[model samples]
Target: MPFQAAPPPPAPPQAPPQAAPQGAPFPVPPPQWPGWAAQPPAPSRGAASPYPPPAWRPPRRKSGAGAVIGALMGVLALVFVLIVIVGALVGLSDHDETVSPIAIPTFSPFPSREATTDTRPTRNPTSEPTSRPTTRPTPVLNRTAKNNTLYRAGSLAKPNCRAGNASIYNHTQFKALILKTGTCMGKAWAPALERVGIDWSPPKYMIAARKGRGACGDYPSPGSNVPYYCPSNSTIYASTSAMAREYGPLGSWNGIIVSMMAHEYGHHIQSLSGISDSWWRQTLDSGSRSGKLALSRRHELQATCFGGMFMRSIAASYPIDTTRRNTLLWAYSHLGDPPGGPRDHGNTRSNAAWFRQGYTRPSAYQCNTWAVGSSSVS
Candidate 1:
């Protein structure tokens, strides 16, 4: 969660105690494992024999050493069966569940932070997108803004270096120009934002909320589960630290973090365009009698589209015919997809189309998704 509290780390699982020698019995209770339960009657009372379903029969034994080896094989088979049976349990099954997609989101959504299951946004990203450029800025963004400064300043053009807290993080490793808190919206992202024409420098005012607890305007309110951009405050707050602990050490946390930061920054882009404020007012004007508080699915999907823009911008650093296309495709697939909960979120296909819409076209005008009768994002 980008705006919620970090959770306590999980304790390591404890091993079951060793049993004492048989003569000096440990006097343990019968194994509660359901495998030990008497078998249920057949699905129908009229079935064949009184015996339970036939136990797995090990292969037939050969003469001497072969028989001994077969007996050992039989014991191993029993252990395997026990393992398979225990795995049928819900609690046991959950323990071994693997998140299918390789990407790890930097943080979970604010509302779904508590949902620890495989609740990643409904993404279907390509296996390998191109790499973003190294720290030095490159002038690859195609632009229409007559007065664009990105070409002039290069990497130093716009500055919102709030989340770059040098003391806490090693910026060089991430390849970002800034560190935590000194930069708020990922200055490593500056070039990408420039690619999308969202080059308005976020002011110090925006930094106040992303700083530490007392950072009051100097920093963001800490929490990862409830990431939001407070229009009144003009700040974006996220607490992905817990999530970092959850997925970072395992080695796939960056893609998730970048995607999420891109999403929040997407909201910032909306604010800059006056869309968020306009929509907020519109939602308020609709009144309680209105059937929904959903200002529109368009808004959320637009942000998803904007996020796609960032990824695309990053991907653009790679040449057109490179293998990175697949990586970008993979990332594009996930961002636009619905994480599968409420209809509030768009699904994978919608996400992919919108992301692709932003990527190939690369324009804010093309991303105006709220017009009547349009699924083409613009």
Candidate 2:
């Protein structure tokens, strides 16, 4: 049995070659290997692979710088928003703290009413031969010694200014008293001005809590004891309430009242003499802060001196004893320019001294405050 040749194992079976589909374009050869034998004809030259290329995946990209930059940008945006909100809150808080109210002082009389208007209707044209009227502007008296009529005014005779009244408390009574005193002042000044070749006219007097639409423009609030002389309207707006409130409590201060009224009257004298106009013109020409202050001091001090002259003229009739004189001097001191404020008016010493000059001498020559140097006025 072992020696038998095993009858040569049957020859391995071989499949015969088969023809490609009858319509094939190219001839086909017999298969070679098992699975890779026919790969659907080597993909015709550049044609895409039949089996999808391993699902495509891009090269891994490093995102380190981009990621960090993006995170930083987000943080900056948030900070900007916070800063805006904080700034707005701080502004509101500061505004709240800065708001408050102002209080008026009781002794703040003489608050200068620093104000006017015309309501004339338009005239209809008339068909008539209008004649040229011959009229001339009134001549202002400024051609006196030192170019000041007051300076040239010689010793003025004592006037009858014996005003009766200690202090009138009632508003109406106070007004009447002022009117009475004004009458006396007019009587004294009219003749004096006439003698100096200056035209004389009494200024309209008024007493009000507040005066508006005055000749000047707008009347300042009244009651701080300030009096105003409106050149445009030739009026004197006196605050009776302010004066009465300040002086009424103190017994009758006839000398003080008279001196105050005289001070205002002095302005009328200046206007008539053209002193005020000249002074104003000089002020405008100077056009400087110190220059303006100098001019204003001279103007105000001159008026104070003129007031003294009036007091002297009336001394015989209304005796201003030492006590009354002292009272008036004190008032003059208080009327001076505030410390560290615009020196429009002279200081306390200058004010009292100027008044005293006129009071003691009773002459316009002695009251030539404008002729003095800047230091004298200051």
Candidate 3:
């Protein structure tokens, strides 16, 4: 249960001064992941997978994998053949051919049969190579391979990343809310991931974003701000309060909220690309900065860009009518910055400008705030 940290505490809903300024149009929309969104009709783990749908299994199932297994099987067959040959050699070496001049009945063609030792040419035995029994070695267990690329899967195809609507607000309902959100966000990012030549094939990787903390649980240190992505777990989770505070209260945009989920999805892509690990390691030696802020900021800004990339993909995939299109843009602006509040939350100016860049040019390279200097942020 202990990955790094709790339960639903009172999340200060009323951030008195941090509240959106007056006349700021509330970027509201229908709640996340409409309840009936279709799940990817594929099996994630098993029949009762976390994905909730079955995968496309091949009609004529394949029995064997490939090269490695075949190589192993071939070696086994060779060993069997060698063992037989070795046994025959040992038996032959033990038996000696006896030729005795036995005095027996002489078949009369005179006494020709009496003393005949018919020996042609003497054959010399040459030493044949005998395979010595070699001790086959066992491969060491690689703990890293098991956790090389971890991922937490969300409940696919539920509405608003939650199970029920306004009627419910319990722990179970909150978890379902988080699960629905996480999976939907995962679904949202799947396309861009493919476009970018990234592979997200499961068993390839996914975290079941459990109701836990830090590495595997809820974020914003819990009861701080909205639910967010945790880079370590490569996941995004939502609690009921976090959902209510972010979505239910129209102080933000639903599209941007979903975009934030996609932003976290960007971090997942970062993890897969091996970029996050490098950043984390580099930060450890980066004594010049206060802790890991430098790397963290890069990660955060990049995720924002990735969120925009998802939005771009979404727009391209479907027709966003005039009203709906504006809704997303409004949502983006509304959720940009919540004033000079929490360090975890990006500042308004940086948020707006970065979102602008992402909307125009959607790629990780375009959002490299690290290169432009820290001064570029303000």
Candidate 4:
């Protein structure tokens, strides 16, 4: 009976073997983060794990006071950079822009006295351009010269000028002479302008030992060679000091003096007719020295023609005998361009020839210096 007990333990009923999971076995889900939902379960059994444990990683640490200090320093550095940029801008705003100074021409007087005898024309300066004419077309003033009737020779009728024979001696005498001559010029030219329907006015005459500065800009110091016509005020500025001292015995060369006066009057006429202003614009536009020189030559040559015409008109009244005529011609011809100087005035031959053209032809059309070749003006 005791041996039967051992068989009794084996006799405990055996349960049926457990079946494989139905459908498919699901994988355990990964742990959820504090604020996140649990992830979905992995795929069926026999498949590699769909959700594996996250990779090994070092734990995160909080920033310390040192890190905070470093961040503050970087912010300060950024502020410093902004301050420097603003300072540079403010500094620049405090200064004025630089400007270049304008150049002023100085006095280099021409030899004061006219030579008694006709001397050989002064040789061209070592740097003078050859006399060959430039074939290129020159820029025209007076609306291309064609449209402005004043530029045409004989556009002005003959000016029956009176003889101006003032015995210029002292400063007072010279002043009187110029005023008388200017008055006579006004009388003669006013009517001529009226005939052409061109406006006319009496030009102011200023005779001084020195012309410092005026509407025309600075005058060369006391001894400058040239007399200037200031269009700004319609004034003629002549150096009585120079003329009296150098060409003294002024009474002897009455025709020459009058002719010189007429030359400037020609410029005044151009101004009245709006030709000079155009010429000046063209000269400024020319830009280059040579281009300006060409334009200046044309301007002066035209004035020369005008002077000749005026001289011819007054010839009977003024009595320009052969010797006086030669003197006048020599005065013009001898005024050669200064060697190595600006060819603002034409060469001797061109100067005299243009003058002669105006004198002999007595027509505005004949004196169209603007239409001639550069060599003729040169």
Query: TM-score, each model?
Result: 0.40, 0.58, 0.45, 0.56
Per-residue alpha-carbon lDDT of candidate 3 for residues 123-240, written as tens digits (9 for 90 to 100): 2212122343556454232112112221221111212232234222355644554455456556655544444445663111222223235555545554455555565545555445
TM-score of 1: 0.40
Candidate 2 similarity to native, TM-score:
0.58
Q: What is the lDDT of candidate 3?
A: 0.47
RMSD of each: 30.8, 42.7, 38.6, 39.1
Model 1 lDDT, residue 231, Cα: 57
TM-score of 3: 0.45
Show model 2 residue runs off by greater than 4 Å.
1-146, 209-213, 217-223, 248-251
lDDT of each: 0.46, 0.65, 0.47, 0.63
Tens digits of per-residue lDDT, candidate 2, 53-98, equal: 7877897776999879989999999999889766765654343321
Question: Top model by lDDT, which number?
Answer: 2
Residue runs of model 3 more than 4 Å from their true location after superposition: 1-198, 201-220, 251-253, 288-291, 316-319, 322-324, 330-345
Q: Give residue 316's lDDT in candidate 3 (0 to 100).
A: 39
